[model samples]
Target: MSRLLHAELTKFRTVRGLVLGTVATAALIVGLGLFVAANSVSVCSKGTVDVECPTPPAGPGGESVRDKFYFVHKPLPGDGTITVRVTSMTGIITYPPPNHDTIVPGLVPWAKAGIIAKRGTTEGSGYVALMTTAEHGVRLQHDFVHDVAGLPGAVSTGAPRWLRLTRVGGTLTGEESADGVTWTRVGTATLTGPVEIGLFVTSPSDLTVHNGVGGGTAQARLSTTTATFDNLGLTGAVPGGGWLRDDVGADPEPDGPVHHPGSAEESAGVWTVSGNGDIAPLAGEGPGTQMTLLGLVIGLIVVIVVAVQFITAELRLGLVGVTALTAPGRARILLAKAAVLGAAMFAAGTAAAAFVVPVAERVLHANGSRRPFLPVPDVVTLSLTVGLLTAGVALLALGLGALVRRSLPAAGLAVAVVVLPYLAAVVGGLPAGASQWLLRVTPAAAFAVQQTEPAYAHVIANYVPMAGYFPLPAWGGLAVLAGYATLTLVLAGVRLRRADL
Candidate 1:
């Protein structure tokens, strides 16, 4: 078996066309990665001057995050409890379609008005909140990405919601209530240190989703929310100071004021806070690792050709019968061929992905793109996933070659099953649901392995194929491709052993 494997490897390296095709796969990945990175540019006007857009802040878990809101807070030198009753939540949405000329009172479903205990006033600081959203009822959110559902109802003047956040040592507990007396523990988070505990309000941009061809499209309009909080209460080692207001993470406008600045007002112990932005994982709207790996589709096509040739070329030359006599077990021969091709493809794909990931990120950053902060380990994981994806596709193609016993048809079938579905999902103008369905059941599902940003139910964004969110998790999607490959290879093995060459 080892000798057979070695023979297959030797044959693989000896074929100039096969060797060149393998190299071309890597070349295409890197080439397209560089192209996309170099072309990406982001600029914003600060007053009359155009400058590069600021990068999003990294959260405690190291993911890029949007953490901006209006806070009416005071320093809590020790563990403390802050409570507030959100009497009303309202918002303004500017220029939403059709007429595109109106500033109207509304709330983008996720708009939040809450009480929070935060490590500091900085963007992306560790925090916990018991918040009432416009449509999602009460929620306990912590560390920018974690969200726990509490009471399920909208907040209004008539039906006010009471929120409480308490810090006990490193643990923060969130609770919610309707009448401010019967509190239900909403959730908890662990974040130690002195914090800013206060009343806060925020609203993310209103998104108008369009069910367009090739997945859904969305447009974001500037929006802000105002929440009226009465019956504010504080307990536990509170310092003597007035409430301070800040628009955390707001970008500076060109007119010298903070862009979309949030404001807070207090009158007769009641506070009205208005703010724009979100405290959530920034996804779908930025240049990500997926963009750098976009070349994989083209690379996969090259791999299909090479992988198919690995098996079908021998059959085409009528050399399989001679090889079968040497190996004796035809299935073993097929296994040897697959092992050699899969390994080579894995090595090439991994190396290309590893090179392109960091290099393309730097290129994108240099070109002023909104580059998300991905940890080194996560980057390595992505590269490896790409490698595995490449290997899976190659194996699938090799099996198809064996099954079809022809080159063109096998390569075409591999692409039809893998690459074409991916194109339809990402570029074919398929509806978002149809695109997600295509990605889930097809070998194209493996592309999910490259998605760096995860779709969060809490974050309001276009979570679709074109936006790089997959219905399946990374390894799960790869496993789907692997399952297809394994089944195809099993059928191919049986054919090889039973059929007369």
Candidate 2:
């Protein structure tokens, strides 16, 4: 078997197109990765400018940007209400583009700052809030996902925005007032567990961009909202004199004033409120991988062409029968063919990723974007994923060549089975709903292994089906591809051994 494998490897290495194709695949991977990195740019919340420097968003489970803020509260494990008046709400929406972080003066119209009745300080918890927007007036939001609009105009210090939240078992109600009396119902929400009722203030701390790959992002720079709760009021299960203060998911900058976002002036009738965090989602409208899809699609095409030609050329010249006899076992010849193709593809893919992932962050940085870093271990895992995806597809193609013994039919079937579904799901280039089930059942599931940013129920990223995002996890998706290759290769071996063609 070793000698047979060696012979197959020798044949593949001697083929100039196969060797050149490997080089071309590597070139495309690195070249395209560099292209995306070079073209992309980012603005930091602080004054830092780097190319796509992904602000390691504080959401622990990647649900929403629920980290970095202040929470002053008393535990109300059951039904409760917390009411307060918001005097004046103001903030700075900063845009620190690649070169410099420019503070944008004041909050945008939709910027929210107000009172919250949360499930807890931990991210992804169920909760609701009655907040004042910069322009849209009062709003009600729940679970970091649901948003309901209220009174449609900015409230002033003189108008006096009165906010209230009342909990009834699983249901919570939000209300707003003008003169600390006539409270108007804003909206309501439902939470299933223990609740934390408190005075909370938060800001956008990150950008929510959508135009394109490097669109103009108006990221939040700073938000220091100072509101006085004069006619102090807490109804139902109020625990006085023991209020816990937390930074939520963020703490004060090491050198900033006020620890835990202004937590030093909580007197009998005073609470200086400020928050530097985003209760929002990350924008993943485009590809986040370091050009893997760009490289994989083209590489698969080139390798498929080479693989089909490699086997069919032998069939055309009547070398298949001769090689079967020479190799002693007909299945051995098929195995050697697959071994050769798989090995070559694996080498090509690994080489490409080695060059692509290492310098990815640096490339983005050179281009003045916030670059996300991948550790060496992660880089190696990603490299292995690339290699495995290429190798599995190669073996599948080789099996198709053996099954059909014709170049075009083998190539077409191989691509339709392994690559077409991927393109369909990724770009909707094919018919609608065609790729969903195809990816689920076909070898194209392997593409899921390349997915870095997964869709979250709470995070509102562009979880578009046409965006090439597969619904399977990395290894699970790769297993589907491997299963197809193994089954086809086994059938190909049996056909070669028993059928005289």
Candidate 3:
């Protein structure tokens, strides 16, 4: 066994394709890794530019609030109650767009009508102008909004204006007040979970808020608009339970304090708030660090092709008969080839993973995404998995070669079995479960290890038919592929024992 294994290893080392494939795999992994690392460093250094940058709010633990100075004409939704306090009295806060044909054009789909406050208006409009039921959608029926009494009129700019949102049961209560201490209820409304709350500003008539360029032109047509916000807050019935706050101040010098009327404020749009609910755990970093274990399977297939060539090329030259006569044990020769192929595959897989895993992690991190660093356990599992897959493909190739005793036919059969199922899965749109199962039975399934995401899991659960469901858990998927390889090897071993050299 030792002598046979040594001879097989010696033959494998001499193969040109095997040597070249190893070199190419290493180069690809390293080059990609460096690129990803450089990008990640650039992303991290951008500081304030990162959307996910941590910015804690001022004051102690209190209601988290986001302030947007300039809001476009769009509705805002919330899981709880919401209030809209207008600081500017000159802008038009209308329910129906000026035109009936087009809904607020360019608005995000999630936008919903809430409250509108115009400037320079009194009696019907004041410090707080409430959005009527006709304006708000059906979801806000249970929620309430209130207009404050003795509210001020519109002005160029001075102090900030504020609105408060408080959720009770399944209802929201909106309140407005001249000062944060005294408040009046607006109206009530309801909203869905993980609700979104934010402000929007639109041009009463294409007026720029900063320079006040268009304000004079649309002055006669402009409605009452008020602007002054301070002490913005949010709260719920539960004690010490609400979304966290992160306060962002006015954009500093250089650019100056220029405000666009119909544009979302840099500090406002789409703020993620954690209310009285659980935050989902971040996904495990390691498993998603690199390509799936399946990538190694492809490398194994290449090794197996080489193994098949090693075996059948000799057979085509009538060397197998010569080898068998000298060795006298066909089983030993078959075992030697299998051992050689498995070792080559294991080495190649380890090297490829060493190169690929780090690069993958860098790419994810550069994008402000987290992933696991390659660890010893993952390496071991991947190496074992690749070894098993390659051995199976190699054994099958050897058996086919022995049966056909011709290099071309055996090579073609090996490639077909290893490559055809993957092509079918891609082109046929087979259900993931069926595809995975078919892949498990074929050499292609070994590539499943390369998947870090729940690609197959999502496919099986969401797309596959109920009766066809055969979803394998991540580790289980690897096992299933490994099992196929083992089975092929066992069958090939049996064939080798019986076939004539």
Candidate 4:
């Protein structure tokens, strides 16, 4: 096996074209990425030109802070408790332009509807809530920006769900229940707010991208969400007070110009608030949230093309037979090739990512936005993720090359299998579900491993490719790609062993 590995490495090293292609892929990863950043500086330079752009620091995943929600509250300078029964919550899903059609399943997984006690109506105000989410069941969230998952249970329309938030001086405890009788403590936070208490419902305005022959923009289809609250019990704050309403994060005179449109209504013993925007730390799309990955997309294309040709070239040139003759076992030859190519791509990917990501961040900061709010570890993790993703893509391409058994056609098919799906997700302007579906099922899903943005349930943004929102978590998405590569490689090996050489 060692001799076979050595012989295969030698064969690869002797191929000047393959070696150069690998180098070029790496170079393009860094070079094209930097170029895209430079271009973004020029275009998004007309970016968020606001003095308040830098404050409220970026989210943990490098997203701009936003706090947009409808509020119905009267000031509580001291301790208080707010409870409400969320009777039902529902909304609609819409597609992008040309034909804007409303669809069902209006609720995305993390949409929130329930009761909140906030410092004030302004965004970034400290707050806490016991709410029924669209899919996460129940949760306790505070700071108007953070989430705390509740006990394992389901909460939905026609489901009897109740939430309670009690403030004891600075300590706040959130509790939830199914029957409004037995309370289960979800989580707690410490806050001293001139608390505003009321019912709130907000959606992330989930985006479905559409890509055509020309450039594409993401269309955010917002569900006109409605959440019913009954048995409204509030202590320490006067009841029947007029609710001073405003879109907390949507500044009419924004830090820049972001739409902050929301309304609250009280009727028939239930208080309902419908919010179209989000309730997050920041108001609108700032420089930190805006990202351009055209170069990386191109780099993905180049990398996969080269990786496919790496193996298909051997088969095309009849050199695979020579390898079989020398290695004694076809599996050993294939394994060695995979290892060699994987290493090469990994090294190149790491170098390119480390340099390009920092450059992109710095360029954006220099162009008028603040730097990405990523810790050193997160940045390093992102770089490593990209490096590992390149390795994964290389392996995927190699497997496809082996399956097709021809250089050009294999490379083309490789692009269709991995790169095309990825391209569609990024710019295809397809429904959010469709785009995410492609990423989840295709080897290209591995690219999601590089996402540094976190999708906060309350924060409203495009939540699409432009904002770096992928459906699956980073490692989980990589596993999907790895699974594809593994399945295909196993099949290819079986074919190599049985087929006529």
TM-score of each: 0.95, 0.60, 0.46, 0.69
Model 2 RMSD vs true structure: 9.6
TM-score of 4: 0.69
* lDDT agreement of model 1 with the native: 0.87
- Candidate achieving higher lDDT, 2 or 3: 2
Best first by lDDT, ranked? 1, 4, 2, 3
**Which one wins on lDDT?**
1
Tens-place lDDT per residue, model 2, 1-501, is: 887788778877898987887677668777777777777765544333233334444332334244445677778878777888877766655464553556555654445667777767776566677888766778887755567878877766677788888889888899988887798998888876677778776665434433222222223334444444555467787666767887776543435644435442566676666666556544454555634336667778777778888777887787777866657786888888887888778888888887776776677666654435556777788888988888888888888887788989999998888777776666554333455577778888888767665564433344434443566777888899899888888998888778664
Candidate 4 residue-wise lDDT, 1-501, digit = tens: 888778767866887877887778777777766665666543221245434344443433344555666666666778878888887776666563556663665676556788777776654556777778777788777655677788755555557698888888888899988888898899998777467776777776775544442224546666556677789888875656565675665545434554546667778887776765555554324223224334555666677777777778777777778877766667667888888888888887777777777777777666655544467777688778777888888888888889988777877877787788887876666667777789888877876765665665545455565456678888988898889888878888888777545
Give the residue spans of candidate 4 off by over 4 A: 42-63, 68-125, 130-140, 145-164, 174-188, 192-278, 281-293, 316-318, 321-326, 429-433, 456-461, 499-501
Computed on alpha carbons, the lDDT of every model, listed in order, comes to 0.87, 0.69, 0.42, 0.70
Model 4 lDDT at residue 446: 77
Backbone Cα, N, C clashes tallied per candidate: 5, 18, 53, 19
Best by TM-score: 1
Candidate 1 residue pairs that clash: 46-254, 47-254, 213-429, 214-429, 214-430
Span of ten consecutive residues with least summed lDDT in model 1: 208-217
True lDDT of residue 379, candidate 3: 59
Q: Which stretches of candidate 3 lie over 4 Å from their true place?
A: 15-278, 281-301, 367-380, 383-392, 423-437, 453-470, 490-501
lDDT of 2: 0.69
